[model samples]
Target: MDTFWKDLEAAAEARDADALTELMRAAAHDGGNGEPLGIRYDAARSARNNVDKYAEN
Candidate 1:
């Protein structure tokens, strides 16, 4: 397996969003796409809140 895959797996297992985001940014750059990823923190926060709300039930 490639180092990139290993790193990605580790980041995923650790639930490191920043690490995953950085890895995705690097992958995009390497693939010739310079556009920045539009990570919607608001949406993520909303989803997390919903999950937490439901989990509390």
Candidate 2:
């Protein structure tokens, strides 16, 4: 989880939308079939929102 956050932060810092999407997909896949889709969606949303918010600054 920490690694995911760190990588997300880096992607956000770089302002790489592709990397962000790929990371989210990778995270969801890693979460396994038992994991709920909502959780992955939320995680991706949070990361994307944060990146967009900070990009405006």
- Least well predicted 10-residue stretch by lDDT in candidate 1: 32-41
List model 2 lDDT by residue over 1-57, tens digit each: 247666767877787777888877777667534566656556766777777877799
Off by over 4 Å in 1: 31-57
Clashes of each: 0, 0
Tens-digit lDDT track of model 1 for 2-26: 3555666666556566666666665
**Model 2 worst lDDT window (10 residues):** 32-41
